[model samples]
Target: MSPPGATRGQPAARSRRRAARVAAVAAGLLLALLLCEALGWPFLRGPVERAAARATASVVSIEAPFRVRFVFSPQLQAGRIVVAAAHGMALPHLVDAHALRADWRWGDIRRWRDGAPLRLEALRARTLDARLQRLADGRASWQLGQRRAPPAGEAALPRFGLLTLDEGHIEIDDHALALRATVDLSGSEGEGGRGIEARARGQYRGHDLDLRAHATAALPLLDESEQAPALPVRLEGKVGQVVLAFDGRAAALLTGRRLDGTLRMQGPSLAAVGAPLGLALPATPAFELVGRLAHDAGVWHLVAESATVGSSRLTGDFRYDGTREPGRLDGRLGGERLALADLGPAVGAPGTAAAPPPPGAPPPRVLPQREFDLPQLRGMDAEVQVAIAELDFGTEALAPVRQLRARVRLDDAVLRLEALSGVVGGGRVDGWSALDARQTPARWSVDLNFDRVAIDQWIRALRRGGAGDDPRRALLTGVLEGRLVLAGRGRSTAQILGSADGDGRLLLRRGTVSHLLTEAAGIDLAQALGVLVRGDEALPLRCARLEFGVEDGLVVPRVAVIDNRDSTVFVDGRASLADETLALRAQVRPKDFSVLSLRTPVLIGGHFSRPQVGLQASRLVGRAAAAIALGVLAAPLAALLPFVDPGSGDGPDPCTAAPRSAAAAAASAPRR
Candidate 1:
C-alpha cells in the first residue's frame, strides 16, 4: 500500500508530534509549581509542607552566626551560619536552634550584660550553662569601666568583665530571659580593633537578670571575658618624664601565687598617676616623674608633687611596697619646711604625754607607720624646699623650725631615722636613732649631736610666768659651745640605759651659776647673761669646763667648776631619778648653794665660793629663734594687712594659694 520513503516520513512526523506534546506538558507542570508557591500552596503537599512548618514552628527570632554559609538556586542549600566582618569581636562556639528560637533570640537591643552563654557541640541546644561577660565595641561598656579610670583624662575602649569564678558563683532566678543566642559570632576588623561573641545551648531564662546592653555602634571595646589565667598585668608606658619599669608580682601574690614580670612606664607630668598622690619621686628637671616600680601584688603606688599637710609642704619621695605582712619602706622623704603643731594627733600621738607611751612604745620615729601591705610600698628620695609659718615655742616668742630635712625608713616596723640634721633654735643638730617596734616589746635608742647653741636666746622663747617675774632671769644666758653627744636606749622608765657627755665652758653673765649650771658650779647671780654673781648688778662669771659620768646609777667626779672671779666651785651630787629631787652642798656667797630648788632627787657634795650668779633652770637659753625662722616674718600689723592673718592656723601654702602677709604679697609679685 505505501512506498519505503513514505513510510519513513510518516513515522518521523508522529515522533516529532509526541516530543512536542511532552515538552508542553513539562512547561505546564513548571508553571503550576511556581503559581502554587506564589499562592502559598504546598508543592510537596505532605512531606515538604510538614517539614517547613516544623522548621519555623515556635521560633521567635534568629541569631545568624558567622559560620553560616548559604547557596540559593532552584533548590536552596545552606551551610552553618557564618559571621564575617572587620571588627574586634569574639563569638560563641555553637548555638541551640530550638532554644534560641523559643526565648533566647536577641531582639534589636544594642548592649547585653551579666549574661551567661552555654556552648554546645551540636548545632542544637543542651543543658550546660556557661555565663560569661560579653562586651562590645561601644560607649556603654566603656562607661562601665570608667568608675576607677575617671572621666578627667578619659579615653576608653569597650570592655567586658567576667570576674573570676573564684570571686564567687551566681545562682539562677528563673529561665525566662528575653535574649537568646544560637550561633557563634565570627569577626573581621580594621587596624587595632577588638571584638567578642559566643553561643548558648538549651538557653532558658524566665526571671533572670534583665541584662541591658545598649551603645553607639561605632565604638571600640573589649568584647569578651574568658576564664583567663590570673596573671599580673604589666603595663608599659611613660609616667611623667621618668622612664621606669615596674616589676610585677615577682613573688606569690594573688591567692599567694607570684607572677613575676616588669612593666615599664614613661610619661609626661599629667600622666604620672602617682605624682598626684604626694610621693614626689624624682623626675625630669621639668617637674615630671619618671621611675620604674615592680610590685608583687596587684597594688598601686602613691606619689606627690607638692602636697601640704597642715601647713607643712610635704614635697619628697615616699614609697611603700607591700610584699610581706608588715611591708617595707626602702627610701627616705623629707621637706625643707616643717609644720605639725598637732603632732600629737597628726602622727598618731595620743593626747596626754603623761598618759605614758603605749606601755613600752619606742619614741616616735620619723618614718611612716607599718600598716599596709609591705611590698606594695615604693621607695622614695626627694628634695623639698619650703617656707614655714609661726608657732608656739615656750614664752610669747614664736618658735619656728626651719630649713629642715631628714632621711627616714621603716622596715618591718624597725624605723631608722638618720641624716636628721636641722637648724633649730639657732643651733645645728646632727645624729639619728631607731625604734624597733617590730618585736612585741618595742625598744628605742637615739644618738644626738648638738653644735654651738646660744643659751640666752632659748630663754626668751618661753612663756613668761608673771609680770614681776625675773625677765633677765628668763635668759638661761650662756655662750654654750661644745659637742653635747647623748646616746641612750630604753624600753620603760626602769629599763632606761644610756649616758651623756657635755664638754664645754659654761660662760655666765648676769646669771646664777649653781641653779642654771649643773657643773658643780655654785655662783648665785641676780641676773645672768654671759656672767653669774649674787648682786643685782650685771656681773660676768666664767666657769671651768664641766664633766660628769654616770655608770648605771652611780655618778663620778660629783661636780666642779672654776668661776671668772678666780673662784673654784665644786659640788658632790647624788640622784634618784624616780623621786625627782636633788640635794646640794655648796656656798654662793650668803646662801651656800644648799639644795638649790631641790626639785629632783639629787644630792650635791661639792663646795663653791661667791661667784657672779643667779639660780635658774638647767635648760639654757638658745639662739634657736634665728635658726627656726626660715621665711620672712610678718609685721606687727600683718594680720590687718592684705592676705595676712597672723592668727591663722594654716599659714601660706606656697604650693596652692597666695600669701597672707603684705610683705609676702609684695615679694610674690606676679611676673609677666
Candidate 2:
C-alpha cells in the first residue's frame, strides 16, 4: 500500500517539471517576436505593398530598407517608394519618394481601420515628386480606388502633428479650372524659422502666372490640435497684369480656423482678375486695393484701407457669411467721390474704356444693350449701404450728384436700390429702383421725384463764340419739379426702356426765356429782328409744363405749354423709345399785335442721331396771306385767355391746368 502512493506522487512531479519547460520556451519565443517588432519588421514590406495597392487601386512598390513596426505605435520607413497612378489614369505615377518616414499612435491606426481618417503624429520625406490632375469631367488623379459614398456628417481631414519636406517637386494640371502649375519646393530651417518655401511658374486660364510663398514651420501647420499656434505665412503672385500679395497667420488651416492678414491686389481690370477664379466681378478700369483680411466661423471679412477703381476711391469693411444658405454679403462703403462711369459695368454698361466694335460690326447702339447677368444675383444675398460725397456723371451736360446715398439689396434674385436720395443742380432727388431677375426677361421698375431743380444748372448749354459770353449766363432760368414712374421687363437697360409703359410730369416755375427766342416763337419777324439787334435778354415766363404718357415705349405729350407775356407756345409730339425717333410740332400764339407774323407751325422730325427742324411747308406757303389777315385785324386774343397770367397771386400751374385735349388735337392736326 505505501509503494503505490509514492509512485503516484513521482508522476505528478514529472508533469509539473514538463509544464515549467514548456512555459520557458513560450517566454523565449515571445521575447524574440517583440525584439523583431521593435527593430522594424522588414518581412512586412511585401504585405504592406500588396495592401497599399489594393487600397489605392494602384501599383505600389518599395525598394530595400522598407520596414514597419507595431509596438506602442505604428511606424513606417521606406526607401525609394513609388505609387503608380490608379487604373484608367493617364499619369504613370502619382507619388515617387526616395525616402519617407511616418509614425502614428496605435489608437489612431485602430480608428483608421474603423473608417476614421489616418492621422500621423509625424511625417518626413526627402526628394519627393508628386503630380496631380483633374479632368474636365471632374475625375481627379488623386481620387484613387473605387468611388464610395461620403461619410455622414462632416468628413474629417487627414491630419499630422509634424511634416518635414526636404526637397520636392509638384505639378498640377486641372483641366476643369484651366489651371496648370509647377512648383519647386525646399525645406528651410535656421534662425529665421523652419518651414517650406516654394517658387511656382505656370498659367491659369490664358494668363501667365508666377508665384512665391513661404510659411511657418511645418510642425505647427500640421498640428490639428486646438492649442496649435498660428502659422505665419507670406505669398506674392502675379497673373498676367494682376498682382497679389499677402502676409498672414492662420490657425487650424485645414479645419476652417481663423486667419488674419494683410492683402494687396492690383490689376488691369477686375474682370480680368476674376476670370481665372470664376468670380462674376463687374468689369472695371484698372484697380488697386489694400485690405485686412480675416476668416472666422465660416465667415470672411475684409476691411479695405484703400480701394481704387478708375477714378473712384473707397474704404469699407465687408463680411461674407458662408454659413448661410446661398451665402450673404453685408457691408457699408463710403467715399468722397464715385465715378458713375466706373460703376456702369455693374449694370451691363460699358466700362470706362469701352472696347471698339469689330471692323465690320454695326455702329454701337445709343443705349447699352449688353444683357444683365441675372443668374449671378441668385448666387448670393447682399445688403450694402453706399454713401458718396459726389457722384460724377462723366459729362458736362449733367450736373454731378452731391451727397448721394443709397441702400442696395439683393435677395432671391431680386435687386433693389432703396432709400436713394441725392442732391444735384441745387435739387433733391429721391427714388427707389428694383430689378426682379426671377422672371426670364427680368422686370424693372423705378419711381423717382425731383424737387426744385435749377434748370440752368441742370441742363448746361454748350459755350460758343470763343468764351466771350459769360459762362455763367443762364440760357433758361427755372426751378423744376418732376415725378417719373416707369416699369418694364427686359434683359438690358435698352430693352427695358423699349418696353416701358409709364407717365411723367415736369413743372417749371418762376422762369424766363431768351427774348429773341420768345419773339421767334410768336413768329413776329420785326420783333425778333429788333430783339436780336438789341442783344438777347431774359424774357419772363408765366409758367412752363411738360407732361407725357408712355404706352408700349411710345411717349405722347399729354400737356406741353410755355406761357410768357408775349405769347403762349404749345407743343405736341410722340417720341418712340423703341425706334429712338422723334416727331414734334409747336404752334405759337401771340398775345399782342405784330407788324409782321407768320403763324406757321414749327416741325421737328428725325432719328435720335440726326434731327431736322423746319417750318411746316404748307403753313409757310400761305404765310404772307395769313400775315396780311392777321395784320388787318387783331386776331381774337380771347382764345388764349386761359393761358394768360392774372398778374397776381400764384398763377395757374400749367402742369395741372393745361388742357389735355388741346395737346391731343394739336398732335393729330393736319400737316397744313
Candidate 3:
C-alpha cells in the first residue's frame, strides 16, 4: 500500500522531526531572552557599578548623622553606610542619617551636554535608626544658595532640579513644641538658573507634635521638559493649653511667593490684671475666637468672625505690619456682655506667660500709640464694648429694678454709652452719655430723662426695707416728673462730692402734701395739695437752688417743698444722714395753729417712709350739719327764759312799764 522505505522509516523520521522541533523552540527562546536582556535591563553589567561610582562623586559630601543604620539590596545597591550614635552632645544633633545609598542617574561625563534626557533609578536606601532635630527654626540657609543672578540672555545651563528628604523630628513644650516635618528636598542644576522644592507630613517623634505641609520651587535653569508649572503648599498645626485651645491653617503659592489663609484659637475665661486696679477672675467664662488671618512678608492682618468672652459675643478686625516698637490697628470691636478680661488673649495681651512659639517670637508686634475721642466718650486705642442685662450699683433702692439693661462702647480715649435705661427712684431713666478716658483724671457727663412715676410705688419699694407696712398708705397715688442734670470731673465716688453742681425739681400731682412732705416739710396732717417743691433745708433749702451734701459721703438733697408760687418751706431743718433716719428739727405748722410742747426744738425724726399724724379735730368738718341743728334749737329757748324771769317779763313788744311794775311788785312778795 505504501513505498517500502517511506513506510519503514516513518516512525523514526517522526521522532527525529519532533526532536528537531524541540531544538528549534529552545533556540528561539534563548534568542528572545538575549534580546530582552539587551534592551529591558541596559545597565545589568559592570556599567551599573561604574555609573554608581561616578554618581557618588557628584555628591559634594554626605554628612552621616548619629545613630543611623543603612541597608542595601545585594543585587542592586550603590554602597552601604552607617552613622555613629551621639552619646551626649549639647549642640543639638539632627537625624541619624548615617547609612544611605544612592545611584546618580545623570552624571557629569565625557562632555555630554547636548543629548537625550538622562534618568537614574533604584535610588534608595533604608535605615532602622533615625533621630533628628526636634524643631525647625522656620528659618533656614537654603542648601542650594541665594537666587542666581538673572541669566544675561536666558538659555542658561538647564537649571538644576531635584527632590530629596531633608530631616524629621518631634517635640513637646510649654504651650506646644512642634516637630520637624519630613522635609522633601529639591534643587536645580546648571549655571545662572536654580530651583528647589520639598514637602512632607507626619506625627513627629512618634509622640510629639502633629503637622503636615508641602513646599516646592524651581530655578530658571530647569529644562522645559523637567519643569512643573507651579508650586502650591499648605500647612496646619494644633495648640493646647489649660486655658486655651487652638488649631490653625495656612496656604501659600511657594513659587509665586504669595500667601493667604486663616487661623483660629479658643479658650474659656481670663482676668484683667494691671497696676492700680486689680480684678479676680472666674472659670467657665468661655472665650473663643476665629480670625480670617493673613501674612505677607512681615505684615499681618486679621478679621475675627465671632468670639466669646465670659459668656459674651465679640467680633472685629485687626492688622499689623512688621516688627515696629508700636504696632497700629484700624478696626472695630463689638460684644453683648464680654468683659475686658475675656478679651486679653485676642488682642494679644499677656494671657499666659508660657505659650507656643517660645517667648521668642520677636516680642509681640509693637503696640501702636492709637487714640480715640468721641463727644460722649474717650478711650485708648485699645477699646472695649460691653452689654449688660442687669447691673447692681450695688446700692439699696428699688427691688430688682426690672427691665434694667445697658450698652457701652469704648475706643480711642472716648467712651460712649447709647442706652442706659432702668428703674431708679420709682422712675424710668432713659438716656446716653460720654466720658473722656484720656483727659487728666478723666471727665464724665450724662443726660438722663425720667418718665411719669408713682411716688407710693417707689415708697412701697423703699418700705420693703423699712418697718412700716400700712394698708391706708397703699391707697396713695401720686406722679412726679423731674430732671437731674450735672457735669464735673472726678475719678471716683469720693471726687463726685464736690466735683458736681446740678439742679433738679419735683412736680407733684393728685396727692396729699402729708404724703410727699411728711418728712421733708412739717405740713397739715390732713390737707391734700395740687403741687409741692423739694430741695433746700439740707443744702440751702431753696425750692430751685436746692443744695445737697456728702457725709462718709453720699450726696443727699436737704428736704424742702416749694409751692407753685415758689414759696419754700423747710420740712426738715438742716437734715443729715442719721444712721437710717431723716432727723427733722421739730417745726409744726398745723391746720389750726398749735404750739409745740415737745420742745423749743422738736426732733421730728422718724422713718420718712411713713409718719404717724393725729388730727381728730380736722375730721369734724365731715359733720358740720349736726352742729348747725343744735345751734338752731338754742335760739327759741332764750325767749322762754326771759318770760319766766317775771321782773324782766317777756311780753309782746308793748310798753312793758305797767306790766313790769306789777311783775316787780309780785316779785317783791314773790320770795316763793
Candidate 2 TM-score versus the reference:
0.78
Cα lDDT of model 2 by residue, 1-672, tens digit: 579889889989998999888888888888877877866878888998998787667788988788787776677899888888644578878878888987889787677666666568876788878776666665655555535423222223345666668888877786755768787777853345367787778887778889777875543432334555677877688977789887899764323356689989999787776565433456777889999988877688889899998999888888888778887879988888888888787767777556777787654556677888777777778898988889888876667889999998988889999999999768899999999999988999999999988777766652223223443345567889999999988988888988998889888898787767777865668778888787877768788888888877777888889887767788887777777777888888776666556666888887665566888877676654544565556565433322232222234445567446535743673331
TM-score for each of the candidates:
0.37, 0.78, 0.37
| Top candidate, metric lDDT | 2
C-alpha positional error of residue 371 in candidate 1 after TM-score superposition, expressed in Å: 16
Question: Evaluated with TM-score, which candidate comes out highest?
Answer: 2
Residue 381 in candidate 2, Cα distance off native in Å: 1.9
Full candidate order by TM-score, most accurate first:
2, 1, 3
Range of the 10 consecutive residues with the lowest summed lDDT in candidate 1: 212-221
Model 2 score (lDDT): 0.74
Which parts of model 3 have CA positions greater than 4 angstroms off?
Answer: 1-397, 400-407, 422-427, 458-460, 464-477, 496-498, 506-508, 512-559, 562-672
lDDT of the structure predicted as candidate 1? 0.32
Candidate 1, 1-672: lDDT as tens digits: 899899889989998999899888988887776665454342233343244224323111222321221111122111221111112223231111222111122220122222222211112222222222222222121222122223221222222221111111112111112223332222222233232121122222221112111111111111222221233233232222334343342222111123334333334322133343223222211123333333234233434445333334444443454443443334434444444432333223322334434755654332222232212122332222222333323233534544555566555445566676656556665677665654434555666665654444544442145323453544234444433333333333233332222221122333333334432233222222223444332224443344344344222322334343323344333332222223343333222223122212123422111112233233112212322332237544332222121221222221122213323322332211
